[model samples]
Target: MLPPILRLLATPLPLPLVQGMAQASLTHILREHPGLFDRLGTFAARPIAISPTDAPFDFTLVLARRSVRVTRRGATPPAYATRICGPIVLLLALAEGRLDGDAEFFGRHISIEGDMETALALRNAAESIPLDFVRDLAPPWRWAQRPGQAVLGAVRRSLLEREGVPCN
Candidate 1:
């Protein structure tokens, strides 16, 4: 279970606040990792876009908030756009080199729309970066698992263990 303070922190905030945080976080990550953008030419021959969609889990995340729309053809660095329910989750995954373009992240609620090849290439480049360096930048809520899950789990167990006293 999460601490009360952490639970409060996980609550969705305003869109503007989320967008501001996303933009600042993206800028910080890009600035700290110069080689990340420099290596884009290796992946995308054409520009690619990624768009993320917010879901029940994290409402404030603005999908595709940090995107590079125009990029050179045959560029080593890949371009991408993403729509994620949690910007911090996406950022942390990117920084940690754990992003899988073909994985079921979207099916699980992390959406990405773009050129498959370019997206894969970008994923490769992002994976090359040292993830640990960006660990401190991860959002506070990420520090613990979501509280709702625990509550739901308890409810499920209670329902399963109770004796059947009535018919529907």
Candidate 2:
């Protein structure tokens, strides 16, 4: 289970509020470091749409103007598809040259749709940005914060425990 604080943070907020927050955050980052996303170039103009299949959950992230749609379904080839969740994370990892791309992290459980090549291209483009620098762009309450690491660790432990696997 997620901690109360995290649950609150992740709670569904009004769409306007969510959009405002995202825009504000992005704007801040861009203003603070104009070159941060320069490498992204056209990719930043693209939009990535994420939707949870079999559910009403859906969102979109416009990168450089390209649109990549991601969706989650009970049974599908690309189970969890979203540029934010999959491509973004993967790109970040790749950019840092730490791309484990572990099946455990993004397994058959998630799927990618539309412009697989573009997604791959974005991954290559992200190579210019350092992961640490990217992490530095978020706010304190952001998931990139230390608390988020703790939460991820707890979740990993819980998953391992449930699977009867010893967690380190």
Candidate 3:
């Protein structure tokens, strides 16, 4: 189970607020890593549905266009070329390259459906980046970035420890 803070922040929040935040997050990430999409090659155009099993919503990732569409669970979602479902913590760890994708997949911690190639391509693209979710996702300001990183890093380390993964 996710921590109460995460549940409280995500579960009852308004959908549009969550979606707008998600979209802005994608934009911020792309701005920080300009080559992220280009690294995906032709697979960048493919739509990938990222479903966080523990979250209240799913994210349809549009890497080519540097956009993300957030949809509430149980709602009709847009068509995607592939779907990847996992716990939100694991998914975030995977995106940050903190966990190996193959190990998780083989261990059944994550499930993938639809196009296998697209999934692989997406995984490769994510692994290629050295992403510090704390620093990357935080506002791009000198003062805020450092404090944000410190707090988020501690939170992430706690989460990973609970998941039995050592935080570097």
**Model 1, span 13-108: residue lDDT tens:** 554565466556655666666565556664433444333222212212212233333212232334233322223334334446544534536545
lDDT of 2 by residue, 64-163 (tens): 4322232223323232223433333333333345543334246542355666655555455544444343344444675557766666566645644543
Candidate 3 stretches greater than 4 Å from native: none
Per-residue lDDT tens digits for candidate 3, residues 7-100, read 7788888988988989988888878887777678889898999998888898998888888998988998889999999988899899888889
**Model 2's lDDT to the true fold?**
0.46
Off by over 4 Å in 2: 1-9, 32-41, 50-58, 65-98, 101-106, 132-168
What's model 3's TM-score?
Answer: 0.93
TM-score of each: 0.44, 0.47, 0.93
- Candidate 2 has a TM-score of 0.47
In candidate 2, residue 114 scores what lDDT? 67
Models sorted by lDDT, best on top: 3, 2, 1
